[model samples]
Target: MFVRSLNNESQLLRKIAEGDQHAFKIIYDYHRRAVYARAIFLLKSEVLAEEVLQEVMLKLWQSAGKLTDETNLGAYLTTLTRNRSFQILRRRVLEAKTEIELRKDWTESHNETEEGILLADTQKILADGIALLPPQQKMVYELCRVDGLKYEQAAQCMNLSVETVKSYMKLALRSLRSYMKSHTDLAVILIILKII
Candidate 1:
């Protein structure tokens, strides 16, 4: 049975490499849920996870010609998904909002000043901390917080159950807490960790 499945997958992969859109769609539809699950796991945001899934699929299609074997297609796809998801998370961290006080440093008639540069550095730190969160936690947290989706909504979007979403969110919070411990106070951490 396993061998037959493997053969079928190999044939599908060969068809995909030959620029068969239907074959690519079959492969994508089969793996889309797993890709989203991984993205949600790493990113803590449903919206971002969805975005990552799209990006991953697009890249996969573009690189179909390079798929040599299907015996480990899942692993290869997972690696690609992880790399892209991390990229999104890292970009989010690098672009975190500035501290309110720092924002005051910028004027309508803006001046490029040393303070602006320092503010940018702080934003980068916040972004890095966010990027450090475990993949699943990041997706759940982001969906709830950044995207303002309720747990149920987020879960639906991620093709996960509400309980699973809650579980993921809990795990994400714990991991983020640990990751950001050095940079946060108890009160602020509590605020961020609050499940809504």
Candidate 2:
């Protein structure tokens, strides 16, 4: 029975690589439950698991040409799903840690009203500064800083070199700092810097 299933998967993979939607659908239907189960088990968030399901399947379809006869479909999918889930988990942890640190800094200094006023002023100045950045620099800032994407990921998204992304981020920071300094007091600039 396992042999039969392996042969079936191989044939479907071949058809999928050849861009046969019917065969791809067949395989998706056959394997999606297992993939979703693995994702949900690891992620423990249905929405995030659903996102992983989409990402893994999209990667599968895009890399179908690389699927060899020796590839164990079940193991390959499980590994992919697991890796994606862990990637998301790591990002979440990083974001949460950053948020906690920022809140700690904020709470240590002022009351809630003061914190809110300072945050708003800092955000406005930062927004104005970002608006002044050049196009590539703005994109780099948004991707790397605001979106919390890694430089490599932002480079891939922008189709630029990683070095270029880093350079843009640096320049963007300098420009934002100069702009913020011109617009607000040192304290406001420092608040924005903490968030950045």
Candidate 3:
């Protein structure tokens, strides 16, 4: 029975690689819930899980032409979903940590009367500074810092080359640093530096 199942998977994969929609549909139907569960387990967010599911299946379709054989189909798909789920989970965690640290700094550094005001002021100034950045630089920086995307992942999301993403990030940091240096006070400067 196990050998028969293996053979069936192999045949399905071959047809999938040859661009058979029914074969692809079978794979999708067989694996979609497992993939969703994997993403949800790692990401802990339904929205993120759904997004990961779409992303993983899209990647499977795109790479179907390169899939080598049926013997590895289950392993390959499982690994791919797991990896992508972990990646998204890690990014969310990093973003949450950064947000917590930023809030902690804001709270500890200022007394009650001034702390809220200072934080609000700084947030506005930072928003304005971000607005001044060039479109590509702003995008790269926001995706990395706010969305917690790594450079390579942001590049993929933006459909830009990785090298281009790196370049945009460098320029974005330079621009942000220059803007902050020109406009911010010492405490806000420290916070911005820490966040970056």
Candidate 4:
């Protein structure tokens, strides 16, 4: 029985070396369990283990012509599984180290300039909001808010009565408040992406 099995395996390997898909499928069915079991046991992650299994199978097919009658299939798969598992573990360690270093640098940079960045963002949003006002409202906002002029001063500069300037200022403030509120989410997203 053992001799018959050896002959079967040798024949399957020979056919796989000639690029026979049916032979490769049979070999895959016979060996996939050992490959997957070893990978899952070592990696402790089903997803990564499945990845290793596919990689090993692909390697096996690619290197099928190297197989000889005396080659031990189980041991060959074991070596491949162990090597690939270690590679994943090494990559994970490297990623963790990189993440830590990046976080440290980002935190330091953010701490030093976070307030300035936020103030700039707010000013931009406020400027955009002001630009959305009607021509008269926009003029009133620039004169009163941007230039720091009192309502009466703005009124004289625009050649209008004090009451009319006050009314325009109120309308501009209300419109700007609504515009700023609507744009808050966009500003927040920009800030978060920049920080990250």
The models' CA-based lDDT, in order, is 0.72, 0.83, 0.77, 0.79
Number of clashing pairs per prediction, in order: 16, 0, 0, 0
Clashing pairs in 2: none
Question: In model 4, where do residues sit more than 4 Å from their true spots?
Answer: 1-7, 108-196
Model 3 TM-score relative to the real fold = 0.61
What does candidate 3's lDDT look like per residue over 113-143, in tens digits?
A: 6766776777777788889999999999899
Q: Ten residues in a row with the worst lDDT in model 1?
A: 1-10
**lDDT winner:** 2
Q: Show where candidate 2 strays beyond 4 Å.
A: 1-41, 44-69, 87-109
Comparing 3 and 4 on lDDT, the stronger one = 4
lDDT of 1: 0.72
Model 2 lDDT tens row, 66-183: 9988888888888899999999999999999999998778745547798798898788778888888999999999988887667866886899998999999999988887887788
Candidate with the greatest TM-score versus the true structure: 3
Q: Tens-digit lDDT track for model 1 on 127-185?
A: 67668777777788888877777786788679899899999888876665565567755
TM-score of each: 0.48, 0.59, 0.61, 0.53
State candidate 4's TM-score. Answer: 0.53
lDDT of model 4 at position 164: 95
After superposing all C-alphas onto the true structure, candidate 4 shows an RMSD in angstroms of: 23.7
- How many residue pairs in model 1 have overlapping backbones? 16
**Better model by lDDT: candidate 1 vs candidate 2:** 2
